[model samples]
Every structure is written in C-alpha cells, then in structure tokens.
Target: MRILLAAAGLVLVYAGIVSLVSPGEPAASPQPWGFGTGVAVRPPEVSLSGGLYFKTYLWARGGGGVLYLRCYVYSRYEGGTWLPTPEEYPVLGVYSVTVGRGPFTEGGALNLTLPLMGGCVPVATPSVDGLQLGSIKVLAPGANLAASRIGLYVAYAGGRLGEVTSFYGPGDLPPSPEDLSLPPGQAGVLLALARNITAGCGDVSCKVERIKEFLKGFTYDGTMDAPWPHIPPGVDPLMWFLQNKRGVCVHFATAFVMLARASGVHARLVVGYMSDGPVPTQWSLTAFSPHAWAEYYQPGVGWIGVEATPPMGVTPPAAPLPRETPTPVATTPEAPPASPGPYQWPSIGLGVFLPLAGVAAAALVGGALFKKRVVIAVGEALRVGAPRGFWVYVNRRRVGRAPVEIVFDKPGLYLVAAGPFVRVVRVVDYRSMAGRAFEKLLKKLKLPPSATPREVAERFPQYREVALLVEKLRFGLRANKEDYRRLKEMI
Candidate 1:
C-alpha cells in the first residue's frame, strides 16, 4: 500500500510540472517593466575634457520587422556656433566602431558620408569612420523558442561622447531595472505626489514627519550632500528619500516620481525650454536650448510639470549700463550778464500810423520768430540692420520701420534706441547740430525749414524707414504718453 502511494505522488508532481512549463494562454498586452511598461534610451553624461563614446544593446521580436538606427552628433564652436549631427567636425583623433554577430547573424557593411558637422554648413571637408549592418538572422526551427530577440551593441570614437535614445519597439518584454526604481502606484498618483512634494508633505505618517523634519532645515545654496539633501545618488530616488538625503534638480525630480510611485502614484521626467526666452542680445541663431523638469500623473488634472531645481540660482536679469563720467565745460571769455530792456516791437508798423490788424499781425510775427519749425528728413531705401525680434523704440515711443520723421516738441537732446535688446543708443542734437547743418544746406539751396517726413518719403521712400530709425536714434528723446500717442498716430 505504501509503495503504491509513493508512486502516485511522483505522478502528480510530474503532471504539475508539465502544466507550469506549457501555459494554455498567451501573455498580457503591454508587459510591465520593473516598474511600468515601455522602453527609453537616456542620454549618458560626458566630461567636458572630450573624447567620449556611446553604445547600446537591444533585442526585439514580433511585428514591424524593420530596424533603423539614426545618429546625430552636435558640436559647439568657441564663438557660439553649433554644428548638427552626422556632420564631421575637425578633431584631434580618429574614432572607429565594430559590430558582433553570434546569437544573431551579421548584415553586410555599408560606408556612407555624413552631411553636416557641428551645426554649420561645411566650409571644409571631413570624413566619417563607421560601419552599418543591415541584415536579419532567422532562428532555428527545433529550438524551444517562443520568439526571437535581437541584440545590438555600439561603441563610439573621438571628441566628447554624449548620447540620447529616442525609440524602442514592439511588445512584451520585462521592464528595465531603471523602471523598477519607480515609486509605488506611480501609474495614477502623480499630481497628488507633486503637491505633497511642493508642500513638503506626504500621506505616509512617517514620510510626512520625515519631510516635515527635512523642511525644518532647507537651504538655498543647493548642496548635493547633507542631512537635508532632498535626494541621494546610488539608490533610487524613493529609496534614497527613505534612507538618505541629497541631490540636485535631477535628483529631486527622480525622487519625487519615485516617492509618488511608492505611494501608488505615476510620474515621468519632462525636458523642455524655459518659458521666458533668453535676453535678445544673448539669444543664439543656431540650435535649440535644452532643459529638464518632471511631470506627475493625476486622475482628473492629467500630467503637471514640477520644477525641482533649487530657487537660489534662478537666471540672472539683464545687466545695467555703465555709468558715464561727466566732463567739465571750458570757459573762454564768457559774455557778461545783459541788462533788461523795455519791450520794443513793431518798428515799422507801430512807429507809423498803422491799423489794429497790422499791430496784431506784427505781434504774431514776433511770436513766430521765437518758435522754429523742425523739418525731419525722410529718405527712401533706408536699411536698419539688427537681429530678429529686436523691438525698435523711437523718441521713447515704439515705431515701425523707417524712413520716418519725428518733430521735437521741445528739442534739447533726443535719444533713440533699438530693443527689447539694447545694442546701442544714438543721440540727436538737431536743434543745435543738425539744425545748423540743415540751415547751412538750406542756405546753399535758398530753401525754407518747412520740410516734412511725408514730403521726404514721397521723394525718397526707399530710405524712409532707415532715415526715421536713425533720426529717432540720434534726435528723439523718451516719449511721454501724449507724445507716444501722437507718435503712434503719425506712424
């Protein structure tokens, strides 16, 4: 009876093993990574000293059967020019690459020339050193394979090595160890977690208390090491938060998501540009500026960006202009103060027996003598060279392109400048300098000081904008509200 029972037990165990080996159902869709689902190739960090390289190993099977590897390398020149990918920049050493095929078969190699280098149009010739493999391997029929997974490894040569991965493929695979570092419930609880982070609060009583203690001693200096550092390295953000304390923006963001996941939340990192564009003069004409922040998933609110970088080092404001030293005026035999005289007018009309209209007209003529008409010369074909998006301010008022003219309400010194970005400022002393010049020119031609910008534009429209821009820069002063309104109307 005992022998029969032992034999029966062995048979039962064998049947159970067979069931475990051969499941009757297909696997679920969107297989979870260590923490979530999907694949990402993160760019690796490199030192500024240069000579860096990147490599990746990949395996994939089932659907869309084609594979593509796109590579772009960027370089920066000393003068702030950026060269774009695949373009070969001049460098000190040569770089090389090799591909291995064993579990996978190797495709034939192809050599191609790269089109761009370091973001600039190639003014000089350069060469690329690499090989491209374009073949697929077929798995043997008798192997115990449910599917085939491919492996791809890469190595880089020369210059500084920096790399970012942008794509990964079709279906069911285990999550990378990076994925496993996510905080619990990270799939759904992103926003609540972010709010807790910003508030220095959390739902877990111990975590909340610890955070409260952490906030009691926060600093603005952005130290990456300490008892109060937000996140630490080596361990994942969540584990670090629970065990240690320290990190920068990268650390804070990573830890925020990790903590959220542990609390049944979902989150991801977001890379983007700052909302405020760079100061006009500081802007670059070539390439995009890059930044990194993070996002958390909330039920109704969706994903929200969370800035973890410390506030101590926000971008600085534009620098102020240097102060100018005043120069002393030289005195040379200055005239003595003059004595007041009785009002004397109408030498011809009043001295003689004149009519009332004549006396009134004489007074008007005298008043006209005190006021000088400012004639702004509008020119055709004016060229105002500047970088894109520079706002042009004229006479303290904004104006559209030249050949435009502005009459000084009361001319002392008028200042004209171009900005949002102020490259330079020009002062116009027409009443003294240009006025005398104009008078001399008019005297030469026997003309009057009644020239209008419109008249100038009609005669020389091509220089109209240019003339106006320069005139404002040289002669115009900052405009008050009334002047600005009038200026706007004139334009």
Candidate 2:
C-alpha cells in the first residue's frame, strides 16, 4: 500500500512538472481561413490587422448536447449600407469590459477587446473588426450551457458602438424585404464620387459591383492613417478614404457603406465574425475573427456579404454575389405565432463534437487539483425522513418535493430544502454498492474522539454536510430526527 501510494505521488509530481512547462494559452491547428496553429502571445498593438482564432466550450439544454444554431445579426440595407434598427436589443451577460472611456471598439487598451456571450452578433464600426468567439451558448427551456477551448486574437479597431443590432429570435418569420431607402445627408466630397461610382449602373446589380470595384484600391491597416494630411472640415471620413487608398477592413467597410448609400443603393454595414471555418455553427472564435463588412440588401436575395478588404493570409468562403448568392443557413424563420408543430422535449443537437478537441487544451492550460478518491454503490436507497415538506436538490435541479423518501443512484453533495430550512447531506453508497466497506471518515477529518459527530458538524461548517455520511458508513446508522434536529439548529 505504501509503495502504491508513493507511485501515485510520483505520477502527480510528473503531471505538475509537465503543466508548468506547457504554454499558458491553448493552441489551434492551421485553419482553412488563415489563422496559424500556435500559442498566442499578446500583440503590441490592439489594431494589429488580421485575424486570430479562439477555442470555446459550448453546452446546450443543460448539457444535453450542443444546440446547432447560427448566431448573427441583421439590419435593413439601403443606400448601399445597413440601417440601424429602432428597437434597442440589450445584450444579456454577467460581465462587461471597459477601455479608455466607453464600450467603443477603439476605446484603446482595457476597452480594446471585449468578451461576449453569444445570442446574436454585434455591429462593430469598421467592417473588418470582428470577434473570434470564445464561447457560443444557446439557452432554452430545460437545458444548460458551458464553454471550453479559449484562444486569444488580435482584436482591434472595428469602430461604431451602441448601434442597435437585431436578430431573428423565436417568433413567426417576417417577410424578406426586396429593397431599402437611403437617409438624407449633406452633399459634399462624397456626392460627386457617389455619382461617378454608380454613373453607368442602371440596375442594382451593376451598381453594387461598381461600388465594390471603387473600394478595391483601399488597403487593410490596423491603425488606418487619415487619408490625407488635412481634410476639409465637412468631408465625410468615407470621402477621405476614397481620396486616400490605405486603411483596414473597418476603413474599407465604412467607405463601402457610405459610398453605396451615396450611389442610391440600399446598403448598410454588417458586423460578424470572419473565420476560416465555413460553418461557425460548431466552432468558437478568437479576436482575429472579429470582422466588419458591407451588405447590399435585395428583397428576394436577402443581405449578401460584400468583400471590400481582401483577406491577408487566408481567404474565407465569400458570400455569393446577388445573382448566385446561396440562401444563408438558419434563415429558419422564427416559428409562426399560430403555426402548430408536434410538441417534443428539446434534445442536445451539438452539430458536431467541437468541445472534445479542448479537453487536452484545458488540462494543459488549467492547473492540477487534489482529487478525492471515493467508492460509491448504486441502487442503495437512503431512507429520507421529512415531517414537513422538503425538496431534494442535486446538480442544481429540484428532484422532488419530499413528504417522504429520497432515493439517489448518484452520490454527491445534496441540499434538502424544507419550508424556510435547508441542510446539506452526503451519501456514501451511491454508484456501486457491490461490497461492504467500512470507513473511518470522521477520523480523517481530524475531529477529537470525544467530539460527537453532531457537535463537530455544528461547530465546523466544512464537516456539517459530511457528518451524516461518516456516521452512516462507519456506524451503520440511518439518519433520524436527531441528525435533522442538529443540522436545523446549526442553520
């Protein structure tokens, strides 16, 4: 036994050594989109142009499985750009990040990269500034969510903050609009250019192509320089971008949206992720994937992605042009208000097993911890006594409202809530009750021999829950009113 224990100790020591030497961040394999497989090192600039990927852990329906869903945002397209919606959608999440001043993407430093819990896509100012999502969670009735495989990306300047981004949630689908209207704007440097850019284009298709061609001259930059030394006070930034050819995806996308609008085509800036992976339904993103782009909406064609900034290392699959554009997936119109379908319980539909890839990454990245060895037997029924009403809570769900007994096949920490009272209980024989094993668990807790289990439980918070378990396993005693009374007194 001593030798076996020593061997186990040595194995633990080896594991600790390996963990210490490994990289702190999870690594990714070379992706089709251009993200390199490597351990990410923080970059010097927030606007370091280009893409990166991150890993994520996703759970659906409370760990039933992954809910295969496409998470993105939509807006009305007119004047060659996306129009902001009227309804303000509040992002629901626990934490928020701050930068120099506000939620602005270019807020700099602390505010540069923001972490998000995915329900819908966010609209960033410049088209290229996009998110490499770390976790994508879908919450529905009777399900759970989790994330894994976290990687870092160079998240930089895709501007525009506090704009309303909309999603098609649970509701009857709305009619697809064929066209949109342009907003009123002052005529300046942009008017003449817009006229010329769409001069010969009589149809929407031709006009859209011309705008894309005009913006092709622009370059992608992390910190895009102002197009010229001094801009006329009234000239729009998009006008300046046209005058100056150098900029990042954000610069190019912004230019496209404005220029398209100027040309009398319905247009809007669309924000979403740009990853090498064609379908994001199964994967997570990194900072490198946060991107902004332009979209010209066609009533029947929907919003098609316009590629203004050419990809640097990898080219992702492009949205087909208006004529050849494929219907975007998850156009699964929200279920109609009165349309009835067969009722069924929601099940886990992880489009793929993406989380399995992160197990090794998590082990290497997360530090080791002491694991308590336990032997539990299944099918062992513990007689639960409750004079008043009680509810047994295991893994966060209330199993039953108890006027009677609690039979558990799995052993772990449990809480029994009755009236305004609650007590923690532990059962030893739960998983596999094949053989009889007597344990001196109380002694391991280092309580004095004279210390009654009840007294130890009352005095020490840690032992309170395990007290019953120790007595049950060691002395073969069933929990009774005395155990209940003692626990109730301590609480």
Candidate 3:
C-alpha cells in the first residue's frame, strides 16, 4: 500500500509539473491559426528595399518528409495604421539538386523589378517597411463557409517556376473565386451534427469520449495516416487526418469539422483557448496555448460546441525526472581473483564502473550549473546598457534579436549585433592570423600581447581602442609602405 501510494504521488507530481511547464490540453473553443514552421534564412541584405517582392528562399525542408512553410510579413502604408497583409497561395515545383540525392534544387534570387500581377501587393515603403501578417488568417479550404477563408493568400506573382523572375505591385489582386465549391447539402449536414454535439456535450470528460467515437468510425486502428487526399498544403485538416492518428486535441478538432463538412454537414471550425485553467500573468512560453475546437448553432442550445478533439496523447517534452519505479536489468557476476594480490584497492572492472558513474553524475550537475551561470551572466550583461531592439545576425543570417549572446559551435568570423549595429568577432581563431598580427604590434610597444583593444578600453575608457589601433597602424609607415608596394607590384 505504501509503495502504491508513493507511486501515485510521484505520478501526480510529474503531471502537475508538465502542466505548469508546458501548455495544458486545449479548451473546447476557437483559436487563431498558429502556423509554426521554420523559414529559410533570407540572404544577407544591407537593408530591405522599398517595393513589392517575392520573399521566397525555401521556408522549410525535412529529410524525405513533406515540408510545410509558413511565411509572415508585416506591412503598413506610410503615415497609416498597420494594415493586415493576406497569406500567399504558394505553388511549389520540385526539382533535383545536384549536390545530393532527393529533391534539392538550385534556388535563385528574389528579383523585384517586374510587374506584380498576383494577389499579393507591396506593403513596404520608405518609412513603413515591413510585412503585417498578424490578421492574416489561414484555414483549411473546402466548400463550407468556414473553410472559405483558407483561399490562396495571393495569386502566383511570376510566371511558372523557372521562368519566375520579377515581382510587380501586389498587382491586380485575385478574388476568392474557385470553381470547386461546396454543396449546400453537405455543409448543412455537417453543421447540424456539430450543433447537436456542441449542445449535448457538457464537460471535458464527455467531449473526450465523443471525440473517440467520432474518430473510431473513420480510422480502423484509430491512428490517422498522412498525405491527406485532395487538400491544399498547410491549410487542410485532412493532412493531419491522413498523417498520424496519434495527434493531440488540435488534430481531432480540425479533422472533425473538415470531415463533417465533406460528408454534407454544415459546420465551421473555430480556434480558441479552452477555459480549463486560470489565465496567465504574462506572455511567457507557458502562456501560448494553440488550442482549437468547433462551435455550431443549434435550436436548443444557441451556439453549441462539438469537441471533435480533446486533450490526449503524448505530452510535450520539458525538464524530466527519474521514474518512480526503476526497472532492473540482468547483470553479469564478477570474475574470481586470478592471483593472490596483496592490498588490492579495487578490481579493474569496479574501478572502471565507479569512475564512469561519478563522471556521469558530475556531467549532469555541471550542465545544470553551467546553464544557471549563463542565464545569470546574460541577465547582468543585459542590464548594463545592453542595446535593446537590435537584431542579431550570425554567419550573415538573421537568427535572433538582441541583447543576445550566441555561442557558436563552429569557430569562424561571426557577425553579431542588433539591427543596423554590427561587429564582426572571430568565434575561434586557431589560425591566429589576425590576432597574432595585432598582438605582435602591441608587443613592439612594450605591452603584453594579451592586452587587446577591448581590454585596453576597459582599463581606460578615454583611450578608445579602435582610435589607438588606427593611430598605431598610421605610425608604422615602413610596414604599411611595404604592404602597399607589394600590392602595387602585384597589380
């Protein structure tokens, strides 16, 4: 009884921690489309030019897996409020890249000197120069009214794939007109079913069961398959339905509304957080819960909810603890002593195992300690006049914002700074080419090679290191003359 109670207590503790650290199960309500996908690193440009352009450069790529890319642009008219730019209808053409096997193709630059005749229009200006994708809604396309919002963002800008060159003004935008329309019968049937479920299902427990029943009829194993048939990329519930039957509540809600409408049910999908837990205090990582469910109008219960998906399945990963009940594995017995050795401290195997165990423990502790130190150090650094609202670019790619200190694994010349402000620092200088040259110059001045420009400035703020370096190089006329002569001779 004691062991069982202890196990139960541990399980409860673990569940609570997970809920606190990550987001809880979604509430039965509507939510905005949280399209989370990796975008390619836009090539390094000194700055963005003011005009309409195709912001394409391979958004997401997975090994042998279908890639879904979500591009966000913030746009505004000069001297006007931020206008919501619509999402784009991307038409992809796969080609083979010569470097390796699979569909990798040589990409081209996004030229913007042509007429833009697509649905997309340029939101950038001299002062207002960004894309506004906040209100841009992306939904699964279908015949139903709800799915109608999931139309092509803008139409194709350039001509077909390779011939694509320039972009005109968000040229004559296309209308939300499609030939394949949904029939009234199908839409009505799905809406009716949704209304019935929303009206009847009262609580989370009841909704979970309802989802189980709904999905059981579709998938034999109750596990969904992938590559949803007849659905557009990134805008289809059918994609999740066909992919993994083992998705969480979001998958169920999406699929439920989609399938219902397909089967002649008048239903619309909604996205919102479930009112399960208390509201968060701040917009921290824990506050963002991408929840989704559906609601339909019923005669009896106003706008009722049909929770096609409830919270279930594997939980998101966070800080983990050891299992309450550790499973024992079979082990081999120690060998007998070969000879009568006097005063043997430990066997070879025991010595090896104990040291290794110590090392593993130390490693775990070291990692935690290191993380704590870094976080604290960064906090301190940020407080000391750390530039705010600056962009961070590494290897000519804008990866993050400032005040950020990025520790790169590979050593090379790394460009780090906030937007518009930049400093090129060498991550690793095993070659010692630049550093050695600078150090030698310092040594000739009877100073230690370790006295770098940054160090000197810290010691005496008035003597700007950059200015001093410039002066020193200026004084070394013979060396400079020799370098100039070499260059002149080469020319």
Best by TM-score: 2
Q: Whole-model Cα lDDT per candidate?
A: 0.27, 0.34, 0.28
- Which 10 residues in a row give candidate 2 its minimum summed lDDT? 106-115
Per-residue lDDT tens digits of candidate 3, residues 190-244? 4555456545765433443454476654432212232123333443333434354
By summed lDDT, which 10 consecutive residues of candidate 3 come out lowest? 42-51
Model 2 agreement with the true structure over 89-158: per-residue lDDT tens digits: 2212211211111222211111111122121223222222221112222211111111111211112111
The Cα error of candidate 3 at residue 132, in Å, is 28
Tell me how many residue pairs clash in candidate 3: 43
> Candidate 1 has what TM-score?
0.23
After superposition, candidate 1 runs with Cα above 4 Å error: 1-217, 220-246, 273-291, 313-491
Candidates 1 and 3 compared by lDDT, better number: 3
lDDT of the structure predicted as candidate 2? 0.34
> What ranking of all candidate models by TM-score puts the best one first?
2, 1, 3
Question: Of the candidates shown, which would achieve the greatest lDDT relative to the real structure?
Answer: 2
Give residue 299's lDDT in candidate 1 (0 to 100).
42
Q: Which runs in model 2 stand beyond 4 Å of their true positions?
A: 1-84, 88-186, 223-236, 276-288, 313-491
TM-score of each: 0.23, 0.34, 0.22
How far is 240's C-alpha from truth in model 2 (Å)?
A: 2.9
RMSD of 2: 25.2
